[model samples]
Target chain A: MKYGIAYFPSKQIQDEVNSYRKRYDSHYALIPPHLTLKESFTADDAEIESLIPELKKIANETDPFNITINKVSSFAPISNTIYLKINPSPELQTLFDKLHSGKFSDDADHPFVPHITLAQDLVDQEYSDVFGSLKMKKYDLGDEVDRFQLLYQLDNGSWTVYETFVFGKEFV
Target chain B: MKYGIAYFPSKQIQDEVNSYRKRYDSHYALIPPHLTLKESFTADDAEIESLIPELKKIANETDPFNITINKVSSFAPISNTIYLKINPSPELQTLFDKLHSGKFSDDADHPFVPHITLAQDLVDQEYSDVFGSLKMKKYDLGDEVDRFQLLYQLDNGSWTVYETFVFGKEFV
Candidate 1:
């Protein structure tokens, strides 16, 4: 089975973001609006099951934080993927490092960049159509990520929720 | 603020189980029925924020699994806590082990054992009253755990949901 991990935005915000995605994101209906943490990887049932306790422990040890979307960007040459640019934070880098350290490493062929994907699998013209329309717009938005979910694609090619883990505590 | 992580039964089951708690458990109204993954711990806002990403990654790595409860059990001497006994499963043990490692280690002084809390902080008579009644009843029930949440203790001393995380994926 193929599985992935990500931080999903709140339902209300996601619904709004997805409205834009319907125009550009092919997987919009297949997956919710989220920032990829660990891209999809193949794992057997036993191997995946074995990782739970450790994941829960890791979750309990970490804390909730915020991310800001500053602008629209993309990987133009390598992959015609357009996304929201996140203003960098040390905490986010630490989190990415921590998650990719041991058993839960990144498996995506592309370099990992923290982004909220607006569109993917596009041709140059398609990318330009959306990027051109969005490039000049300012995106000063943010969200507090307190929890994240694990997702998997079924035989029918639909993404399904497999599990969710909340951050360790409520800091506010 | 104090915080905890637990697996709560479905609403229907929780409602029925809570009725029993109302008669026996003093904290019935204060909290719902749950199997705690992490006991309450104290941490600052920044520390708690740093844990969210790791927690989400952990949740994603772990797959959903089933748990069964066949009988009632307790820690009678050290504490007057009565709980539903969970059948032994390597998955559960692994989950516990994973959750207790490193920075997010279990802070509670009590030994960690997997059981759903039915009643706790009881006086001698209260303990005997409920324990004797419950011990005789066989509880042949099970549930699939696909998600868990972080809980916080409000200033009013009531527990509230801080955030919820679901299991990674379902492969059929």
Candidate 2:
């Protein structure tokens, strides 16, 4: 089975993202609007089962953090994937590092760019048309994320939550 | 740190359980109304980190199951713990066995008896007074539980969710 980790934004953020995704993104139905924390990785039943404890430890050591989406951005020459750019924070970087280390040490294909995809798989003409208008729009949006979900890809290509890890220590 | 696993009922069920817990259970504020799936066991940070994967496997193999609460019951001789008795199903038993086997093989002090603790640590007279009335009343309440939470104890002797595992296979 294929597994990945992600932070699902609030309903308000999802609704906003979906408004654009429904028109442009082909993958809108496969998964909800989410900030991809870790890219997709393959794991058998035994492999994923053993990784749960480590995931929990990472969650426990980290505190809930805020994310701000100040602007819309795109990967132009690379892929033409447009996204709502998330402002970076030390806490978010630490979490990204933790997942990409040790048991979860799978190097990302691209450098860490925190984003929620708004539209993707566009041709040259449509990509420019969408990116040009979106870049000028301000999106001063943010939310406090307390948890992240470990998701599994269904046979139908849709993704569903396998587990959720909440951030923060039990003790002070 | 100490960790345990449990299934938390819906808010309606929790509210009903809390009605009695607030008046009787000495450990009421420490945790919410829950069905204990695994007893408290000690683990260091590293130990817990390593155990997460197996927990995920158990969750993945199981399916969401239903529980019917039919009557009030008590562990009179064993302990004065009065509870809302849960009628068991095969799925629930399978999950219990999975947790007790292999890496999680810590023998339970008592055989599994699924119940949501309403009142505990009662004196002899109080135990009889509470159990007497509660046993006579019928509770035809039930709920479908799709997830179980791994909880940790806090410094203030309270419990908080560390992670949540949802049940079901990703593919048919």
Best candidate, lDDT-wise? 2
Per-residue lDDT for B18-105 in model 2, tens only?
7888799997656767899999888887887777767777877887878999999999898999999989777888888888988886
Model 2 sits at a Cα RMSD from the real structure of 15.1
> How much lDDT does each candidate structure score?
0.70, 0.81
On DockQ, the candidate that comes out on top is: 2
TM-score of chain B of 2: 0.95
Q: For candidate 2, give the DockQ.
A: 0.08
- Report the C-alpha lDDT of model 2 over A82-150, residue by residue, as the tens digit: 999999878888899899999996678777899999999998899999999999999889988888878
What does candidate 1's lDDT look like per residue over B1-172, in tens digits? 5777777765444555665666677766455667788888876668767665556566677788898888989887878988888788787776666666765856657656888777887889979988998899987788887777776664434455555666563111
> In model 1, what lDDT does residue A166 have?
62
Q: After superposition, how far is residue A100 of candidate 2 from its true place, in Å?
A: 26
In candidate 2, list every pair of residues with a backbone clash.
A49-B53, A49-B54, A50-B53, A51-B53, A52-B52, A52-B53, A53-B52, A53-B53
Off by over 4 Å in 2: A1-163, A166-172, B169-172
Tell me chain A's TM-score in each of the predictions. 0.89, 0.95
Give per-model TM-scores. 0.51, 0.54
